[model samples]
Target: MAKIVASSPGKGILHGEHAVVYGKSAVAMSVDLRTRTTVEPINKNVVELHLPDLQTSSEWFIEDIMRIPVTSNEEIEDAVKVSEALKHLQTVLNVQVPCCTDAKQQSIYAFLFLYIEISRKYRGGNFPSVKVTVTSELPMGAGLGSSAAFAVSLSAAFLAFYGKLDKKTPLSQENLDEISRFAFQAEIIIHGKPSGIDNSICTYGGALIFQAGKIKEFLPEVPPLKILLVNTRIPRNTRDLVASVRQRFDTCPAVIQPVLDAIDAISRQSWQLLKEMSNTNSLQKFIPLLKVKFQENILHLLKESLEQAELEIFEAELGCNG
Candidate 1:
């Protein structure tokens, strides 16, 4: 088979950055850039893996692949497991595929997981050793959808290389859906909890409104919503962010409830406007309401009255810069 190489973009939350981690609805996107992977088949039973961006590479004996851990409760562990699984497949097929050394240890794991999982279900083969390389334009951990994008890219690469990807046929929709589901699962392996919005957006490559627990209903396109993401310049861990919110729920429930409720209201209104607003005229009419709700609701939740300047900066950063 020809060398399989693929790429997918990372993403960030526009409004629901932390909220979605707690099963709440929020908006997120596939940013302008991504992580990529390449799978090449070699002649021997040894797999070489390289990740250019991270500057890491490693080789594994295909027969000894099952030694890598596959079960994990966290993203890091999940990533290693994926790597092990890929080695297992290489051994199973008795084919030597050189994996990239450049990807993060965890990203390599995730790549292996996607490749093996997707391959097991759709196609089986034996081949010579090959080289795989991954590159990306996105930052490693900026709350972007780096992990999901990488997973999607791997899935796409495997499907394309196997000649199993059929975008033109309606029967392929089932395969596409199944592939997306597996990709999301792989992401959960990389991210402790993912809203699946990033994968969906990267998978479809456009704008979407994501609602918690509403898979089919929540994913709707909003062409007129002028979306932009502003990083807080502060690197926030998904785990820590979720934990803080959880702590608030446990120790400060009364104080936290209103914030969540108000944010929820904003999300709802935003979705409504996204559906209703079409042309520039409609967008201009809706902009003020959108801005006001976002500012007021986020301000109240942030308890910014404590820091007027902090609140102003927050609003200015998130606000439309004209």
Candidate 2:
């Protein structure tokens, strides 16, 4: 039996949160927390999925998945077909049909979606019998890109299982791109309209600056930073937050637009500082000066853009600046 293991890192937005939605630049970096997927071939013609984080385990015979009669040359070609396949898988597994709010069901659906599509794409419509176990260190629905990490890991593992991966050396750029593409497809199942940055950062394993839906690696040659991920244990709805921001922008463009532009400027400056940090041989010597300048500029911009009441409210609520 062949065994393959692949892992991908979670991500967080360094800057440009709400502004990124409005065609602005955002910086996102992969965190240390990751998700790992293990694929082991089984003698019996069955595909089993074990997602411990979701407290779900399911198995289905390859013959059963094939009997559903859904085929496409490409995995992402037909959304309706994929939905139908998900429904069929849900029925076969005796699981509830997935809704947008149901994270557990959605996760299971994503796993089965990738499993069937990837197997069909690479194995020539012959579903391989394998047991996939996914484990993660990241928390779900925390704006931490946990789902993206899971998707990337699953994509890489399935590709490796299908003999598409080169195990002798480091993964090539082409390999990473393919993995990112598949992961992005899976992400669409979880996030209705994803910006593609999370999967890209997870696949590339570094900092990335995403602008207007385009992604460029940030200091790829430089090693990843040791980031501290402090989970507030707050469960916030991303869609609702985004919608609220949009509504605010629509309601008070004069006020919100300036704040967004100020944030964009701060993010751009931070990106420049990151570039300088990468270039400087003695980061320890330069970081102190850079920090002071960054804070001064950010404060100046925020004060200029926001009203006194707004600034006080922000400081009181966020507790970042006293």
Candidate 3:
């Protein structure tokens, strides 16, 4: 039983959040904050989970987990399959089905979901008894990719424990892809309709442009930018916010579609500016244009809906002097 440890960075949506749900382009970048998972083999025939961020710890007997019917990775392909699997786990664990309403429960479900899936996939019918511990520097439910980072780290740890990962060197592209795929499955269990951008950025790190379920990582020439991640301590329900946006789109597609299109344009422009900035040293020259475009296209659209203080806080978070 090898002791395996892995960590993955959280991510922030640089541009295009709700619009991405409508097949529009978006950009996400990996933040310095990370979630780390460490797996150690135990002599007992039980698997333990310790999550400091959630302030919970539990252990499941390997025999009990093995008693549950195992689904092949191919069988659990889509969200429906993932949901079905989650339902089965809920029955086995005697927990609530829709556990997302509780942060601690949701985090536990995600861990169990990933642990069962990855361990089953790699270790076959023989489940290993391991004590897995996780700790994170990321803020919970801040629209950052905390869940994705957790999933990625767990996937990597499980893979490493099964001797499927390279022990000597950095994870290769192939390894990253596999980790991302597993993390995406976990995301589906949590988010229901994740775009895969969060998992991709967490696995590969740096920045990426994602659109319509496709992701393109930033080129090496593009230097990573230092960013300030300020937690406003403001809490909002993502489902409610998404529903509100969907309602607006449903009611006025003619008007809202153009706003979404403008947002998409801004994202594309920002992407291009990033590329140009990578090639040249004069990054400041594009800041004004980018600011103007953001103000005109995005801020203008969001102005009426967001409170003045909230808007000001966001602007300040973006490092806007105005």
Q: Which model scores highest in TM-score?
A: 3
Cα lDDT tens digits for candidate 3, 121-220: 7777688888999999988778888889988999999888888887666678889889998888887766767778888889888677888877854653
Listed per model in order, the count of residue pairs whose N, CA or C atoms clash below 3 Å is 27, 0, 0
Model 2 residue 161 lDDT?
87
Candidate 2 lDDT for residue 270: 73
RMSD to truth, every model? 8.7, 5.9, 6.8
TM-score head-to-head 2 vs 3, winner: 3
Instruction: Report the C-alpha displacement of residue 25, candidate 1, in angstroms.
Output: 1.9
Q: Which candidate order results from sorting by TM-score in descending order?
A: 3, 2, 1
Q: How far in Å is the alpha carbon of 311 misplaced in model 3?
A: 18
Instruction: Give one digit per residue, the lDDT tens place, for model 2 in 1-322.
Output: 4899989888888777667777777777778788999999888889889999988898887877886555444644545555666667667666666676677766777888888778777876788888899999999879888989999999999998888888765699889988988787777677655667778888887677887766854657543345566788888655455565666566557776766676677677777777877876767765665566446545644324444436655767788553
Q: Residue-wise lDDT of candidate 1 within 82-112, one digit each (tens)?
A: 4455556456545543333223545666666
Candidate 2, clashing residue pairs? none
Which scores better on TM-score, 1 or 3? 3
How far in Å is the alpha carbon of 176 misplaced in model 2? 0.7
Worst 10 residues of 2 by lDDT: 300-309
Using all chains and alpha carbons, the TM-scores for the candidates as numbered come to 0.72, 0.80, 0.87
